[model samples]
Target: MAGLDWQGWLTIGVVLATLALLLWERFSPDKVLIGATVVLAGSGILGVRQALAGFWNPGVLTVAVLFVLVAALKSTGAIRWIGDWVLGRPRGEFAAQARLVAITSPLSAFVNNTPIVAMLTSAIEHWSRRSGVAPSKLLLPMNYATILGGMCTLVGTSTNLIVAGLVHQQPGMPALRMFDPLGVGAVAAVAGGIYLLTVGRWLLPLRRSALQQATETREYVVEMLVEDAGAMAGMTIGQAGLRGLAGSYLVELVRNGELHAAVSPEEALRGGDRLVFVGATDAVRELRRLSGLRPATEQLFKIDDAGGRRTLVEVVLSAYSPAIGKTLVEATFRSRYNAAVIAVARHGTRLHGKLGDVVLQVGDTLLMETDAKFLRRYGNRAEFLVSNEIDGAARVDRPRALVALGVVAAMIVANTVLGVDILLSAVAAAALVLLAGCVHVAELRRSLDLRLIVVIACSFALGAALDRSGVAALVAAHLMGWAGSDPFWTLVLVYVAAVAFTELVTNNAAAVLMFPIAVSAATQLGVQPMPFVIAIMMGASAGFITPIGYQTNLMVYGPGGYRFSDYVRVGLPLSLVVGVSVLLAIPRLWPF
Candidate 1:
């Protein structure tokens, strides 16, 4: 502090303020990081070129391209297909946990773990209902598994790519290979998986899920029709995956004008059969994703011209509407409003029977399927009081799923085997998917996570400031004084610091902030920088003690009915297990 210059003090202040703002959750991460970059560049602490260089970094561009690739795969249903194939019916909780770790850990190595977790959360909820297992027991472990898997490959997580990009910026440093972290990551993953399957399983709470709680309050009645050429036509109700739906139950089945109430699980389903379900709103939304089943109303197909580009919206009927007293069929609702009503609810009471036969009421809430533009078109119209589009409701293109899968495989081969750069490989894959019609340009634009890209690009300025202002070296000197300058002890301190920063800030930010300190520490010890680099990468992703530590953790917090203590109860042990394994393995793999 005595010898510090103005630039060093300014950089330190900006970094501390950034961490405080992020932890306070006052603003979005992108906004906070961008503001810090502006401050540094404006104060002459960093040049304009250095502040904006992150926007053009190879790692940042690669992350953006990968987002498009993941969106294309999701739109084509390839990721869901893989999940279904690998998660074939497990008998019990332990067996389910084992199967989940096996599939998610490996799959996340090749693809981004965030989308993988997002898609699987719903799938796991369905499985929990069918197997009579509480979702709270499975969701947290699944989140941890993805985080562990992400440590295996460079493309597995954004943190790894950001660290690699930093490494590439150094003089005389070789680029990191795809499997550079495999030795230590694989060992840590194995150790973490074992703890989850045994001790962590016992510690998980058995609280009711959010869907289960919602079922107790509000319920909606909806009907789904089986297609003549669909896969579920000849199967029994149980075999068709409709036996024990979570927060929903089958009321009856109608075939050729014959009514059968209290249908049995063994009852066979036939083409053109109407199955009535009474459940919560989430259950209805989940039913929409099932193959071979559609809303009973034919208007659903007639309203949206864009195939696989529709969303579910909730609209409340107002007294000024013309169809308040007439039935949906009599009012010609589809032709009049360009939307089809799939389900209706009135003051916590569930309506039953065919959607067309139901008479519209002034206060009834209607769940309709229409094009994405329906909200923009009719948001202000007096025909509806309130209109809101459901999130993650877009339809998938099953026909082009295989084409999207092929494109992803080709991208991996090109990067790992053909010796092409990852940025080029990702660009080519994104282009191929667009050309093959697996995902539309508009849909891709809507799905791209621009906020995440901005945060990654803007964070480079903070890292560069720390280096140029000598703050990183000053911190490294203090760390060496405390650790007695022993390479192993210094490595431990570096790893511990990274883990702490990640839990307080974010994974990518922790990596960027710790990169300069790690390099300075390695230089002071006269050791290869590779060990310290790998340590930072592993520690930054080992955020398991808190939900806010990782995005995936927060994603499951509500759905799993988890409290903050639940994470500590289950995650603290997992953090130690992974930490010990990584610390021991890094030294042997890349000696310091």
Candidate 2:
């Protein structure tokens, strides 16, 4: 250690500190990564060019472009159609898991898996209620299936592109073809899919969510108004689909300044009647979408722009929320937040009153009708514990769906057949979507996950620091020495190392750090680097053992009501299956 150069030791110190912070999980991943990058650059361990190089990396830019493309797909209803078509009504939980894996596996091979999981998570949450399946039983498998599928194609995951970019930096290494990892990756996907279907079902626990427990304790009391022009006008309560709504029931009907309690199921609903309901959040959510029904308060109408587009957002009031202790009307919530509360639910408590008269309280979950910018505007504020757009809140533009699909198809062809550079093709596809109005330029800001982009870009900087400071070479040499002359053990070591590190850090960071080591290890063994490269690629994505390991896993963690150990129980076996399959298949496909 004393013999090591200052740059090498500084790089090692910075990396170790960054790892400590990431493992602590006290701060955002992006903040921790960017902070580390700045420190390394400021300390003179890395030059400005090297520290900032990741921002321009093809992998980072490509991922940014893909986000726009995905948003376009979602805006046009293309993703929704694909999800519904692929996950058609299945009889039971096991059948539903099979359907999801079958569809997402192949779809992820061409499309980025993160957005796919994001798009599907909410839908699956909704479906879980309807089909009597626990989201716990479906979400983990859904996330894992996408990861396995991603392993099969070059463009499947940003991790693959990141690794390919590294490979291009090496002299004498040929650029990777689209399906280079397919043979091994597909086999592993199939093996893991089977294991999930057979063994994972029993391993995953059936746990009700906190929201569910809250609902069971007490139902939210909400008021809805029947609009004059809505098809629901003049229908009986029973005929309007308000009777026996899942998790909800009509409690009162107010019309012409008259209050009718214990309203009969057969009571006819008249235009402008204020119907009161007691139900769970899910039930309330369904009620909000009912045609001709509007929130009793007129503020909801104000959220609609001249373009007539509206989005539903969930805002969790914190101690700092301005509306705390103030009634919605008093807060002037419409003008204040630029959003209108359609419904409000306090955990395990129910309130009775007109919508506007109910005073806001800390910990209340307000469902607002607003635009996409709502997330960006209040997401980082201390006033709210959470501010996020509700997935599937808006109607799909079915007319634009085909055009979005065509643009995506052209992107695939341009990269796979026409040999256009992946980054350029992605940009061109993104432009086509924007120009065609699949996704408007105004919509792009919130559509991209800046945290994801920053983390990837910073990971590139860290990788550069590792390579330039010789830490990467030092680690690889020691690893090769530890494994001796055995190529098989060397490959397994690389894979195992990646999997272990990924559980502690970002998936792309794990891949970035391991790529140089894998390449060096192959060079030390006097063998082709492709096998080790493939091993690193597959292993970096194999983050099933913990929620922190993969972005998709974390995305579903809270929503699915999953504990940390839940992942180990179900994911361990699948990880083992994938590990064995990759080891056995990699040598044959990309021989050592």
Candidate 3:
């Protein structure tokens, strides 16, 4: 250990930095990880060749490839095939929704959750509107179901892979066994399902929109200055605290003659960049005056074209969303998919007027309109959250259903059965399915969540540090001492803390920081780590208190006209219910 080279110390330091940024919420995890990689590459911690290894990290690639498979399901309308399987015999609004949750919750075990939400958002909206049940009734469950699904498989979420990867690295440490946490996750999911059916409904926000324009309306547009500002000058919208302006938002920061790459929450704002803020008409106007900014575009609001063949709406992207951190240009959103972006809102910043140059990122709200054909054609191209609730039947493409099912199935089989890493299988399946004409090559680009890539890549670097820096091990040791030999207590400490942390930062970030602690705890107890890990996976999804917790919740917060308390009112109970469920099931499935 004393003889470890500069590369070892550098690698360890980089990983420690990754954990610090995420755990402390000091800086953007993506930014921290990317910077760490460059630094580590320079020090030869992972070697010049291995430094880029993160780019090829199976977890990162699996997430990206899964995007394409999900897109194919959405594009081909194969997801629709499964709709009947879940929603066919709805007992009532509550029961039907519960059933939907039950089915989707399980499927998420095999795949990621963003596409599941994208595939369902419209359908749920349409179902609620048609049945006269509030969409608030279904959405919380949708988010919960997807989250629970993520707990079932290692490849389901990047968090799981991070845990598996790190644990495997420790000498004598166990690599994750298939279905190790399945029992615990299933129990948690079940308890959560019941809780959602019961107390969860009371906690959800009620929001529905009949008019497309009213729903899609860009909040407000204001102009901000980048002149001589410290952080703002070098910062992007995300980095400039502009995205933090939740209630009111800034659209874009205009610099001399050029729009920035994308309005990332982590992006640095540069001096002389004219910032555009979009929020409530009143808030937008007021913030402009406060910030000494002006409007870059005239009044723009959404128009309801749902009744007609054409429509306009806004979409908020989830962290896992394929649309994270890519512009319409790279995804060819307009030409290939045939939709136009009239404006974009990254919380406080509003991207309007010059749409073509704007790069997109997760959590950025997009305002656009197109005909039914255009939506139908391009809907599967990008994984965007419904910033504005959409009104229509969740469209289906029967021709693409087989492709979707086969590709997804092949991926799962490749990972679990064939001993291939899930990511490799997913990439291969996506490529083969697309080349085989199941999905278009163009669709692949549209489905990637590039920002997520950045986040995952960075998280991996952090995972390295958690192990090397002795931080994760230390934390685990502490928790084990406190929780003692009680498996229940251990689960409580790991799972409960995971839920709390995720609500504060991103889930991927939360897992990276907490995983080492869980590993350490397992070591202290001299018991297997599976049960404790199940706790983290379930806990990360427990962010139900505020719109800020999960991107899904944030996407719905304003759109639902939900107050911060609304999440607490509903999400708290759901969190507990899920928590209890994990306790009951994990012991059985992965029995410590």
Worst 10 residues of 3 by lDDT: 207-216
Please give the TM-score that candidate 1 achieves against the real structure: 0.73
Residue 417, candidate 3: C-alpha displacement in angstroms: 6.0
Per-candidate Cα lDDT values, in order, are 0.78, 0.76, 0.61
Which prediction has the highest lDDT against the true structure?
1
Best by TM-score: 2
lDDT of 1 by residue, 164-277 (tens): 888889776788878898899899899999999988899998876544443332345667899998888999998987855654556557789765544566888999998867
**Candidate 3 overall Cα lDDT vs. reference?**
0.61
Tens-place lDDT digits, model 2, residues 1-592 = 4546998998888888888988765566788899989988898888888888888887788887888887787667677677667678888887899999989999999878876776676677657767778777887889899999999988898888888777776789988777788898899999998988888878988865333333332236567899987989988877888754665546456689765544555778888998766555555687887898988773222211223344656555654467878877688676676665555655323343345667876556665655556655665455664444554453567878888888888988888898888888889988888888998765676566777788888887788888778888788777877778688888888899999999888789999888877887788789999999899889998999987788677656655667778888998989999999999998998877
Model 2 earns a TM-score of 0.75
Q: Compose the digit string of candidate 3's lDDT tens values, residues 286-405.
A: 554444234445432224435544355556654444444565656666444344455565533454433445666655656555444545444543355553335555556665677668
Clash counts for the predictions, in order? 0, 0, 47
Candidate 3 clash total? 47
What 10-residue stretch in candidate 1 is worst by lDDT? 298-307
Which regions in candidate 2 have their CA more than 4 angstroms from the true location? 1-3, 217-394
